[model samples]
Target: MHDFDFVRPQTVSDAVRALATPDAQALSGGQTLLPAMKVRLAAPAVLVSLMHIPDMVFVRADGDVLRVGGATTHAQVAREAAGAYPALASLAARIGDPAVRSRGTIGGSLANNDPSACYPAGVLASNATIVTDRREIGADDFFQGMFTTALEEGEIVVEVRFPIPDAARYEKFIQPASRFPLTAAFVARHSGGARVAITGASESGVFRWHEAEVALTSDFAVQALDGLAVDADGMIADLHGSSAYRAHLAGVMTRRAVAAIV
Candidate 1:
């Protein structure tokens, strides 16, 4: 491993200071970072570890929002959030293996914003907030591209606030190798209308499936999801799943998600 300054800050302010550097990298569960470092893929001059911050690992339900701290692990969310938002909790339970769940954090996952990741879809459908010391970014604006986010330098995700929905479900077909979603859907019943977010299908990363949303909004039924057209342009095309296959699965999983919720 390359020698570098490893800073473990106990507070958000300290973390911010550590990240003020031009080449500082935020460390969350180290699921992605450590491996990259081992292969010399990433060589950050300063490693700012967020794990020691006690205040960033809590979960609470306040009125209409379910606020989850950035350091909260998937396993932690799986156990604590199940009773309140079963869909999200179940989604957390299904991310990666048990080891990954135990250490992989929401903040890290959101910061990484993998194209096939699960939380982005759920957050988008739930209309969640990606809270940071700098600003609170809406789900629609937070995620920008594959493995990229709207997070600026020195900005760290403090928490995620998901608006509690009436009903919700996340369904996906996991690619066996990496366990990334080949195509996934998160469907929710909100006050304005039914929301359906699709991930793993598009090169633009996770996005709301408007075609599927339109069909479900009209009838809010599984059968209504039939004949929905998902745009194949700029979709993910890889060895695991073709762009067309992922597009088709987006519709299928969307209907399945709707069925699961309704």
Candidate 2:
């Protein structure tokens, strides 16, 4: 790993200032960043730690939304959000192993925006808001592509606000080695409508399966998806599975998620 200056900031403003240093990068959990650094995939001049910022670590329900601080760990979400949003909690619980769960933060996950990561599906399906130090970005606009997001330099994610759905569930077909989803689906039904988000299968990144959403919105049942199918053209094809295979799993996982909620 390259030598880098490390700064632990106690406040969001301090962290932002620290990030202004040349080639500086924000550090939260260090689950993905650290690994990249070791392989020389990333070489930042400085590391601005957000873990020390108090306001970046919290979980609470504000009226209709479940507000989760950006620095809050996956384990924290698993424990704190279960009562208010069980589907989110369940997704958090299943991310990586206990060690990763304890260290990985929701903000880090979203900011990193790994195509196979679990949180994006939940955020997109729930139509959550990604609150940054500068402004609030809807999940639809936040994710750009694999390992990409709308976050700008020196910006920091403060928290995420998820609208509580009447019923929601996430289902994933895991790749045994990394525990990342090979194909995953998150289905959320609200008073307004039903939304379906799929991850792990798309080459472009996590995306909504609109046809299934429309079908399920009209009839909230697993059988409603019986005739529906996900197109293979946009799916990621690798050693674990072919594009068609992952596309099939997307439908299967979506069906399972709907079944769980129904």
Model 2 TM-score, 2 decimals: 0.99
lDDT per model vs. reference: 0.89, 0.95
lDDT tens string, model 2, 111-142?
Answer: 99999999999999999999999899999999
- Which stretch of 10 consecutive residues in model 1 shows the poorest summed lDDT? 209-218
lDDT (0-100) at residue 124 of candidate 1?
93
How much is the lDDT of residue 16 in candidate 2? 89
Against the hidden true structure, what lDDT does model 2 obtain?
0.95
- Candidate 1 regions with alpha-carbon error over 4 angstroms: none
lDDT of 1 at 248: 84
In candidate 1, which residue pairs get closer than 3 Å at backbone N, Cα or C atoms, i.e. clash? none
Q: List the residue pairs that clash in candidate 2.
A: none
Tens digit of lDDT per residue, candidate 1, span 26-137?
Answer: 9999988898899999999999999999989987888878999999999999999988889999899999999999999999999989888999999999999999977899
User: C-alpha displacement of 230 in model 1, angstroms?
Assistant: 1.0
